[model samples]
Target chain A: MSASIYLDHAATAPLAPGVAEVMHDVLVGAPGNPLSQHAEGRAACAHIDAAAEKVAGLIGAEPREIVWTSGATESSNLALRGVAEFIGAGARIVSVVTEHPATRDTLSALAKQGVTVDWLEVDAHGAIDHDALAAAVAQGPDLVSIMQVNNETGVIHDVPAIAEQCAAAGVALHVDAAQSLGRLPIDVSATPIALMSLSAHKIGGPKGIGALYVRRRAPKIGVAAQIIGGGQQRGLRAGTLPTHQIAGFGAAAAQAARHGIASQPEWARLRERLWQGMAPLGGLLRNGRPETAAAPFLSVSVTGVHGAALITGLNEGEPALAVSTGAACSAAKGESSHVVRAMGRSPREAAATIRFSLGPGVDEVAIDAAAQRFRDEVRRLRTLAEAA
Target chain B: MNRGAADDAIRARFLRPTYAVDADAVDAWPASGAADTPGEDARCRVFLAVGNDGRLKAAFAAFGPPVVIACADWICERVTAQTVEITHTVTLADVEKALALTPTQRYAGLLAIDALSNAVINLGQ
Candidate 1:
């Protein structure tokens, strides 16, 4: 079997080295439910608590303020539903069109439950309209939710600016940091964000574990519980904590802190290398501004080529180039990416976009291979197109 | 997306699609047909070039998912060099069977048939 160069880090990054060992240690060493009052249970609870601290440390939040959930999707649902339920009906919620489906679908459900919904517009470059957002904020909306980094486009919103606006407006802010959690430095205490959603899988940790940072000090926030059972997590979330997964997540978090946004420059250089390598092939259009986007992700749409065809072709080749046509959810749905559509791209462009998200251990040779593979596929498909 | 549902043949055709189209041979035929369809969230255009002797040269342009593209390539390969009247005898089931399309990919077969039927209609034979 030929080795593949994976470029779908936005979907789910591979587990970091040593993370599996940490998880295995916990799985074998601590096998009791965290809820039990026995010594074994206490040992399990200690693992859970240490994991919580690690996750909190990554975002500069108090461990007491973090609530664990199944992953970013559940964290999103819990954050949105919990807050919406707390604020009650007739409250207004504002969010951008480029949010992940977790937040987008939850907001749609909130709309159905009698909360008014207003969508913030994004420009062609995928930047949120600051003036429009300020005006919306002035309308006295109860909550504002925006993603820190767009999953498909890698566009980074001005979270601190948005947080300040929401704070001045007396509106609670929820930042979906799934894409930005490990890639960016997020001090929840300094950002004025009331709630933030984070995922472990996106940061070289295990899947099926995530956390929500609820501001507990200044601008203290409370959320109604979405899942109920043993009244764990102070009633915010309830279940027997997965110590193994939490341990992996904690180890991942600790590892992430050692670098803490220092690798961004290298990531940007590698992204540029791929882009430049393919630019000479022509018909390349970037989906988001590189200056504002996350360093590791480069989303480009090609003219005169089918996006899905390119994706499949790249993956099927020798030394396969594994990338994404869009976000993981929409890619499976076999639909044009909504993030590209929201950026004012034509339906054809939306269908032709490919997201190249890099990760650790991806060297220049792999980037060149990916670029060459992309060029070959585009040429092949375009020749077929012209003939047709 | 889990593409494991598709057989290796279909998967290979979708990936490399060696039978997609030939640039020099497309415009030289005397009779031709074409069809357009809205696929999933994209569009597909299938074209055929027919010789005076009634044989076909098939080519397709698609912006849809892998299933639709592969289906076009599969049908084009099957129909090329066959008599122009073959479109009348061809069934959606034939194309689906040839591609080993999964249930989710069944619509791609319909699309292929639609395009092939339209190409035959455009032949005006």
Candidate 2:
């Protein structure tokens, strides 16, 4: 009867009320563009600057370092290009096999453009081997990109250790901390990260707005203004900043700073509840590590499950329960996750996989209900399938 | 035990006699879902199974001529002219529960729907 038990936080989080209210004020009242020179414009600009400062405080970066973009996809692009081109890093970028498609495909595109690409491999646990990182950086590429927390696996990489390696090699590092910033502690001052990408929607902020932290010194990756206009955001990303969304993102960021630590425990408890519920089922297999992995997302695959059918069935049978079998970006066509495949799961195992992601709103009761419904459905369907 | 992907996709929707499906599509199934090739003889019966990606998973039915009770989504390891014992179950759970029923050495396509634990396994020939 109420809102559905939303477990797919990694897909997109529900906006916080605090963020919503702030955004409402800006959208309803703010008139002139933040870029306009009029008093109205200056008022809007002040609102944007304040919002950026709040976001900067959470990540321990200067407000001047933050440049806004449409969202993570663009933020990621800006980081990769703005640094790579600015340094003219010889078109070769070093990274790992588990990078999100944003970085992976971007590198792949660069590879086609004669950029040398080197990738560090991860073990079954999704941990990057230090030896592999050393090897990938040995040749000295223009830039290296790594995501702080994996979206699907939730595996936390040693970004600082990685930063040290990049620093030693004199390679610029770009950390796609979209999943990490809100849930995990990030101190850009300590970490040798040159460029970092942040998305508002991922942290229960408004959708459309994301930011990039570009260190003035190591600005090698030059993105030739994908949206050239009034040269806003250090001229790297130029457009009329969505003041309302920025205000919402700032509110979300502030809320994230306040309640961030709660996310991990909330997810960990639900995840444990899920594993306990699934223990009796002989065929189920856990996908990745929780604490080391992304705490909010849990992927499990039963020995003989069809992932697409399972997701659809879960959505249909338990209206309050929502889940996914593969990457939400690739959900429309029923393609299995390449991220899982990189972890060495067979296609069948990958197909059987279901991603049970937890959000801030999810509680033990919701977890139990969803798990019970899932088990009941699974048992019923399997029994019937056996009968069929 | 379960409807084969072929059965699930075709069912009543695409099986009309006048349904304009490509002959190549018709050609994929030489001997499944019906008894005998379209023109071959009453002795030859069709078998239906889900095709994972490309190859057939298991034989589910042989409806034309009604030669014995059709075992759905089975490989029909033994298909004689008069009787076709569906050697395996169509769905995965029945296949697992009827473990003694299935031969130990056989390749099959097994996929469990995530929404439910019950698996849909198709034994390939």
Clashes of 1: 0
Give the per-residue Cα lDDT of candidate 1 at B30: 41
TM-scores, one per candidate: 0.90, 0.75
User: What lDDT does each candidate get?
Assistant: 0.82, 0.64
Give one digit per residue, the lDDT tens place, for model 1 in A107-221.
Answer: 9988888988899889999998899999999999878989999999999999999999889878889999999998988998688999999999988999999988888866655
Model 2 RMSD, rounded to 1 decimal: 11.5
Q: Compose the digit string of candidate 2's lDDT tens values, residues B6-92.
A: 333222221211212122343454333322222211111223334444433322322111111112222232221212223232344
Q: Could you give the CAPRI-style class of model 1?
A: acceptable
lDDT of 2 by residue, A170-198 (tens): 87888999888788888887777788889
Once fitted onto the true fold, the runs of candidate 1 whose alpha carbons sit more than 4 angstroms away are: A1-3, A327-334, B1-6, B25-31, B39-64, B79-88, B102-125
Q: Candidate 1 residues B27-113, lDDT tens each?
A: 654444444444354344566776778677777765556777788888878888998777788888897777777787788778777
Clashes of each: 0, 44
**Which pairs of residues have clashing backbones in candidate 1?**
none
Candidate 1's displacement at residue B67, Å, is 3.7
